[model samples]
Target: MIVQLSDIELTARTLVMASQILVILLGFTIVYIAFQGYRRNRSRPMLFIAVGFTLIIGVQAISAGVYVVFDVSELAAGAVSQAAQLSGLICILYALRMEG
Candidate 1:
C-alpha cells in the first residue's frame, strides 16, 4: 500500500497553518497589551494570556511541521491533532480566566 497527500490532507494542512497564524497574532496582541499594562502600572494579566497563546501556537506549529515532514501515519496524525486541541483548549481556558 502507498499513501499520498490527498485533497483532504491538503485542506487540513491549510487549516492548520491558518490556525497557527491566528494564534501567533493573538499571542502578539497579548504581549503588546501586557507591555502597555506594565507601563501604565496596571494588572498584567495579559502576560498569562501571552504565555498560553504562545504554548498553543508553538505546539500547533510543531505538529504542522511534523505532519508536513514525516510520513502520514495515523498514529502521528492523531497525536498531533490531540496536542493541538489540548493546547488550544488550555489557551481558551486561560483567556477566559483572565477575562473573568
Candidate 2:
C-alpha cells in the first residue's frame, strides 16, 4: 500500500526534520566544547557534561531512527527517548554537583 501525505503534512515533517538536524548539530557542538574544556582543564565535570549532552541529544535521534527502521510503537520509542534524556539530565546534574 502506498501512503500519500498532504502538502501541509509534508511541510510540517520537513520542518520537524530540519529542526531535529539543527538540534543535533548544536548538541554536537556543545559536546565538543565540553570535551575541549575537559582536555584543557582536566575537569571531570566537563567530561561528564560532554557525555550527558551526547546521551541527551544523540540517543533520542538514534532511538527515533530505530523506531522508523524497525516499525516500533510510538510509545516504545518515546519511552526510550525519555529514558535517555532522563539519564542525561542525571549526568548533567551530577556534573553540576561535583567540585572542580
Candidate 3:
C-alpha cells in the first residue's frame, strides 16, 4: 500500500479543520472567562476586552456564512477573508491596550 501526496494533503486539511474547531472552542471559553471577570470586577477595561472578543467571533461567524453563500466566487471569498483578517487585527490591538 502506497500513500500518495494527495492523500497527505487531504490529511493535512482534515487536521487543520480539527484545529480550527478547537481554536473556536477555546475562543468561546476565553469569552466566557472575560465575561465573568467583567461581571465580578466591574472593570471597564475587562468589558472592552470582552467586547473585542465578541466582535472577533461575530466577524468570523459572518465570514463563514459569506463563504457558504459565495463559495464559487473567488472574489467574494477573498473579500470575506480580508474582512476576517482585519477584525482579528483589531482584536489584537484591543487585547494589547490592556498594557497601556
Report the lDDT tens digits of candidate 1 across residue range 68-87: 79877767776876776577
The 10 consecutive residues of candidate 1 with the worst lDDT sum are 42-51
Writing each residue's lDDT as its tens digit, candidate 2 over 9-67 gives 99999999999999999999999999999999999999999999999999988998999
Better of 1 and 3 by lDDT: 3
**lDDT (Cα) of model 2:** 0.95
Query: Model 2: which ten-residue window has the lowest total lDDT?
Result: 60-69
**Top-scoring candidate (TM-score):** 2
As for candidate 2, its clashing pairs are none
Q: Model 3: residues >4 Å from true position, as ranges?
A: 1-5, 71-74, 77-81, 84-100
In candidate 3, how many clashes are counted? 0
Return the candidate ranking by TM-score, descending: 2, 3, 1
lDDT of 3 at 11: 95
Clashing residue pairs found in predicted model 1? none
Backbone clashes per model, in order? 0, 0, 0
Q: Which stretches of candidate 1 lie over 4 Å from their true place?
A: 1-44, 72-74, 95-100
How do all models score by TM-score? Answer: 0.47, 0.90, 0.66
Q: Which one is best on lDDT?
A: 2
lDDT of the candidates, in the order given: 0.67, 0.95, 0.71
lDDT, residue 82, model 2: 97
